[model samples]
Target chain A: MTTDDQIIRNIISGEQHAFRVLVNEYEDLVFTMCYRILAHRHLAEEAAQDVFVKVYRKLHLFDQRSSLKTWIYRIAYRTAIDHQRKKRVRTIELEKAPMVADSQDDAQVLMERSDEQQRIRRGLAQLKTIDATLINLYYMEGQSMEEISEITKLSKSNVKVRLHRARHKLAEILSRKQMEAT
Target chain B: MKNWESDIWRYLASELMGTELESFEQALKDDPILADKYESAQRLKRNLKDFPRLSPNEGFANRVMQKLPAGLNRNLWVQKLNRKPAWYFLGGAVLLVVVTLSIGWPQGSAASSDMDWTQIWQWSTQLPLSFVCLISAVFVLLLIDRVVTR
Candidate 1:
């Protein structure tokens, strides 16, 4: 497999296809990050495109000190946050969770899962952009505090404290949502 | 009670270990409020852990590649533009307006009166040579800036 370093070298050497490789690797993660912040799939897709475009332009400045994943993540986070800040006045619309159906049982389970996903998405939409992002980096992506710190530029302790706070806030929102649903 | 939230989150995350873990679990069994908090945190953790993965539509990478060339060209143009001061463009625009007025005012005046071509030529020639040269220089510089940036 071509390593990340190799991919970067190839891209810097004018191998445009290498960028596709990089984008393919991180596209879902970047899209998910954007979706978490923007709370709309269409906006998330646009933001993801912007993130890749930016990464392509700024690839030369990567420096290789941090992992490529973290670097792309930082770019995705910042771009999504910028979109959110600019469009704060716009109402958020949740994208319907996609369903896969191979069997009746599978369809049933997927429907339940989709409902849960929608609930989580709604809860996240209620949060401030930074808080939602912190929760996403911590739980959804399963990033280490140190890695989250690197991606977010927050201190490790700050990441920890803020992540905990965000977790509590998300729990509060989810519980409130559940309370209302019943 | 004040620290119960973090404690419950820590427990849910398995960040609490050994004695801390034991004590929190004990508190969970003893205090109904702490138990309730733990239950909620555990549920949230489970939901977040199982957070549905979102994917972009197919050919996402291909679309990105298609966008790359145009994006690169635009970025290069912007970076080149940024290297020069805005005042250069502003000066060019101001000079262009002045040149248009200088040339247009005489034509306008001539058309309004019985003044013929010679009178207009004389008026033009009577204008300061230095001002004309300055306008030419500004126009040429603006053209050169545009070419170099392009």
Candidate 2:
């Protein structure tokens, strides 16, 4: 296993193989991040690929001031967010046309939960983007609050507050659904 | 429920830790309403924990690798060397030496006596004038050839 520093040096030295090694190591992490953020397979894959290309072109600009993983993840997060923004704009443009004949079916399909498990996923989806991101990073990825704060550029206390609110929102959504079902 | 209900729930979810955890436990113990909120929070956390992960399908790695940019197989040293400005400077230096030696050799052998210090200095002074005249002559000849061909 090549150390992160060694991989960086190899990349700087123009070793194509070294770039491959670096990509192989971080591909899953980057892809997972994009997947979580985008929630669409094709878009997530494209975003992940774009992130690697950006990393390759901008590697020389990397100052080694932070860990390579953190830098890469930061890039991945930004890229995913940018893609999501663009996608939202496109969706808004399409919203003018009564494009949906039966939007109710989609909501019904989403509501069919075998257990409370689906409620959590639904709640997660409904939470604010930053809140959902915090939960994913903190719970799903098992990142420390400090790491989450660093990634999101939020203060530690702010991250705590957000995480607290995010979980509460999710719980409230779940409970509401349960009550409606009864 | 109190606003702290979420914090209490997060603590039960194992998402909040350390001082936050102790504080939340104390809050839950003190307020019955807070404890009831904590129970719902625990259920939600448990459901989330049990939620199935949507892993990327098989061949996902292959798909990603296939989409990667090309030109990754090129030789590193060659690529680096091609990008270095020093190589162009070195080439220019070699060309200068070759041209100087080629021009100087015939002149040196033809006028061995004129190659002496005083004569060499005189020749060096006239060299720029000779170069200008030679360039003009080449241009004139090319012009004449074009006119004749027309």
Among these predicted structures, which one has the highest DockQ? 1
lDDT of 1 by residue, A73-124 (tens): 9999899888878777232344233444333223323443566666776677
List the RMSD of every prediction in angstroms. 10.7, 13.8
Instruction: State model 1's lDDT.
Output: 0.71
Q: What does candidate 2's lDDT look like per residue over A124-169, in tens digits?
A: 6677668878887777666777778778889999998898788767
User: Please, what are the lDDT tens digits per residue for candidate 2 over residues B48-117?
Assistant: 5443334344455555556555554332332343323444544555565556545654363657665667
Off by over 4 Å in 2: A89-114, B1-7, B10-40, B46-150
Interface RMSD of each: 5.7, 12.3
Model 2 lDDT on a 0 to 1 scale: 0.64
Candidate that would win on lDDT? 1
Overall lDDT per candidate, in order of appearance: 0.71, 0.64
Worst 10 residues of 2 chain A by lDDT: A89-98
